[model samples]
Target: MGEQHGCQTCHGDTDAHVADPTMKNVLVYQAKGGSAVDELSAKCLACHDSDTHMAMWKMSKHSRNDISCFNCHTMHATRGAVDQPTKCFTCHRDIKVAVNKQSHHPIIENKIKCSDCHNTHGTATQHMIKDDTVNQLCYQCHAEKRGPFVWEHSPVEENCLICHSPHGSRHAKLLVEKVPNVCQDCHDWSRHPGTPYDANAGFTGSSPSNRFFARSCLNCHGAIHGSANFENHGLRQ
Candidate 1:
């Protein structure tokens, strides 16, 4: 309540509030506070300067879309951090459903937060990803996939999304689709028999083939991500 105190950090110019207890004289960030989005954000930006994680906030998707800081944060709220997946999922309903899928990144388990890979404050990337590229972000955890292999998978090097879904997947290992099928997306595999093709296929192979006999494509091609081994050009290492 004092000038030297930190109350003024957010409740800007509390003199009027002190004078009139009933007056909505102080700056409030909520809708009933009658403060504009820009005005409310300006108050936060005044302290959260654009130097740290808040850098490039003006270029952020949330900023461009008129999202306010209070939308995700309530510093004086009831209990512990309410801005976890609970707050994020409120707006991102689709991702909420995705995270509950068979294969996910342990978000529901509370092992990770959305901020682990995303910068809600601001970012230069499309999805507000913490890193410059999707592959770079995935490399944070899947470091083995980040290799300077002699036989580099073009899709793996280009984007991890091509074969995997970051949020979740019905397929194991967060794969976008079942094996051999995911491979057939580019390999154009029609030579061998017993192909239990994807949804579009008319003939679903009944007999077990080399591709689906054991662990599917992983049976022979384990290092499908990339291969440093000159011994196996097919990346079977």
Candidate 2:
């Protein structure tokens, strides 16, 4: 915040970054490079710890998890030399895998950023999410799903994560699981006698094969996310 100068101000004794300034005493954040995570972040925080957004740094998830400023921000590079996405993926490989699946947010395409839905700096919400709840964050992009509908799906009314995977999914709609399986999580309790929705019980066997194919649940319950209808049993758009 004040007049700051020289690499030594942040790096603190350039020789320390070097294992020996001559040999192997220097520490590395990676298998071989730079310094320790705590040292680096502490140095940065010594200068920046007073900032408004950084007020919660002491209690932040990243701080507690040993994440340093360099984890997301690079020093001594051109303005945009580093890619935040790749840096983020380094720690969150699980999310990296999820986003690469068939259906996902447009993060890889650069239409979205990890920071778009997450503060990453600090937040009161779990996962450092920017909103009070997952559904609230999702409603920023999917306002249609935030309906005060005439009929509400129980899980949908509760949490979007119950039916959807926010990162990505192999399923067509970022669904947590496949369609009927997603529906079956709730609807499997009740069924008629001698007429099951399994692989062998529909219209002379042809019905089961065709009707219960991929996303058969959606074919009937087209408005699965939610529907505003007062008729048709409230499962329509």
lDDT of 1 by residue, 1-237 (tens): 223537777887788788888877577877667777878888887766757536777788888888888877785777556748999998899999999999999999999999999998888787989999999999999998998888887899899999999999999999998887788777664543444535554434432455344235665578888888756645464
lDDT of 1 at 205: 42
Question: Which is the leading candidate under TM-score?
Answer: 1
- Candidate 2 — number of clashing residue pairs? 2
Which structure among the candidates has the greatest lDDT?
Answer: 1
Off by over 4 Å in 2: 1-4, 13-36, 49-53, 191-215
Cα shift from native, residue 66, model 2 (Å): 1.7
Q: State residue 125's C-alpha deviation in candidate 1, in Å.
A: 1.4
Give the Cα error of residue 25 in candidate 1, in Å.
5.6
Model 2 C-alpha lDDT per residue in residues 1-237, reported as the tens digit of each score: 669687667655666645555644433434236567777777777777666457667688988987778767766667667666787899899999999999998999989989988887788888888889998999999999888877677788789999899899999789888867777777663541113365544345245444534335555567765677856444444
Q: lDDT per model, in order?
A: 0.79, 0.73
Off by over 4 Å in 1: 1-9, 12-26, 189-215, 230-237
**Candidate 2 clash pair list:** 19-26, 20-23
